[model samples]
Target: MLRGSGVTTLQYTALTVLERRGGISAAQLARDSFVTPQAMADMLRALEQRELISRSPNPASRRELLVHLTEEGRRLLAEYTDAHAAIEELMLSGLSRAERAHLRSSLDGAWRALRPPR
Candidate 1:
């Protein structure tokens, strides 16, 4: 979905998840994205090295690290968001605005319903 829109899938997914979930631990991201913990850690390390994200002390858990988006990360995320929106529009070209909204809402609801309880 991302490469079709001009961004790498990993970059797009990481940015989108960070934008939506705020700062999260690498472990949490592994669970959320369905990626392995080691894979998520590797991705996070790469992102951190690129200055796109920073590993900071977690507010809720002092011993844990939280991944926060840097200014560059936000900029990339904005670009990714635009690309994603364009992809969505192209994919849903035949649907009316209301139908698209309904589909989005229903999908979100279904996902939430299937998620494991906190």
Candidate 2:
């Protein structure tokens, strides 16, 4: 990946999490991503500065802040997801659709098996 693409990975991950879950906290992100609280704080600040994330006080917990993706962030994430899918399709062009599905299932199963129990 190029220098610019490096930020895309982090941005995309954060955007996906926010989009799917609605909102999350910096501490929750630290736990989920296995990063230090400080690291998560810095990352969140960077994302907010880019206008890709919006932060607000949590309604349930005044002390905690909720992080959510801005509309611009959602658009960027959609584009990123489409580009990623296009790349995957190009890479798997040699494989049949069934083969691709099987591979995806196997990989997803392995990932789930390795995840920590809830």
Candidate 3:
């Protein structure tokens, strides 16, 4: 489904993380997106080639490169938002509203618990 939209799952995940966190270092993005540093570097290059993201040197840390989503990236992400919502709706169609809420809460909790401390 995502492939048809020209966005891979990893790309979508990275885009969403950037949307939520704003500009952050490539290393930080890698950690947040659950990808290795090398993988994130390659992905960032691909995103740059697509003009979906921009990277700049961090003033605070010369060694770090801050990554940010471009307007094009945000637009693509918005387009996918509706598709994701439709897919989620279909996946959760069998559950009641309350059950869905509980499931969401539990999943969120698990995610938080599993993430490494900042």
| Tens-place lDDT digits, model 3, residues 4-68 | 76778998899999999968988889988989999999999999999999998889989888999
Best by lDDT: 3
Give the winner by TM-score: 1 or 3.
3
Better of 1 and 3 by lDDT: 3
Q: Which predicted model would earn the best TM-score?
A: 3
Note the residue pairs that clash in candidate 3: none
lDDT of 1 by residue, 1-118 (tens): 4454444577557767887886788887777766788888888878877787888899789999987778888887776666668887899999998998999999889878866789
Per-residue lDDT over 81-102 for candidate 2, one digit per residue giving the tens place of the 0 to 100 score: 7677787789899999899999
- Candidate lDDT scores, in order, read 0.77, 0.76, 0.90
User: Compared to the true structure, candidate 1 yields what TM-score?
Assistant: 0.80
Positional deviation of 52 in candidate 1, in angstroms? 0.8
**Model 1 stretches astray by more than 4 angstroms:** 1-7
Superposed on all Cα atoms, the candidates' RMSDs to the truth, in angstroms, are 2.8, 3.0, 1.5
